[model samples]
Target: MIMCREATKLMSLKLDRPLTRREQLQLRLHTLMCSACRRCESQFELLHGLGDKLPDTDDTSSRS
Candidate 1:
């Protein structure tokens, strides 16, 4: 089983950029055995994508 720390680190790395082949293999192995971590990873990926799709607002006039 992948420890929480390692899973968290992998999660962060995934958010930063595409994983190397070794990293991808490791993540796959970890997820295959750890359903909880897999779910967490999926949630993080969904939330990250959602954040990216959100529009940025610089104008404050609407609030006035």
Candidate 2:
């Protein structure tokens, strides 16, 4: 079983690129068994969607 940390990493990567079949399966299986990871994934997706709707701001302080 994939750990919550690894599953969260996969979820983040999914935002930028499609996961490989194996990666997708791992994340899916992990989320199925781990409620906390599933909630984290849901919150991340919601935050991403909200961010997409906001206009991009030139906040240099936010960038490393």
Candidate 3:
């Protein structure tokens, strides 16, 4: 079983990219026992959807 910190990191990584089969299995097993991670997973899923609607900015763009 993975710890909260590690699970959270994997949760974020999954949002950015496709997790490997091993990673998917590990996270699935962990979440089965951890409601906190399950909540986090749901929250990040919302963020992933919102990201598509947000504007794009780059390093060349100046920050206010």
> TM-scores for all candidates?
0.76, 0.86, 0.80
User: What's the ranking of the predictions by lDDT, best on top?
Assistant: 2, 3, 1
Candidate 2 lDDT tens digits, 1-64: 8788899999999988999999999999999999999899999999999999999788996899
Tell me how far the alpha carbon of residue 31 in candidate 2 is from the true structure, in angstroms, after superposition. 0.4
- The stretch of ten residues in a row with the least summed lDDT in candidate 3 is 55-64
lDDT of 3 at 23: 89
Higher-TM-score candidate of 1 and 3: 3
lDDT of 3 by residue, 1-64 (tens): 7788888999999988999998899899999999989999999999888988898879666866
lDDT of 3 at 16: 82
lDDT tens digits by residue: candidate 1, 1-64: 4576787698889899998888878888888888888899999999999999999877886686
List candidate 1 stretches off by more than 4 Å: 59-64
* Top lDDT prediction, candidate number: 2
Q: Residue 21's C-alpha lDDT in candidate 1?
A: 82
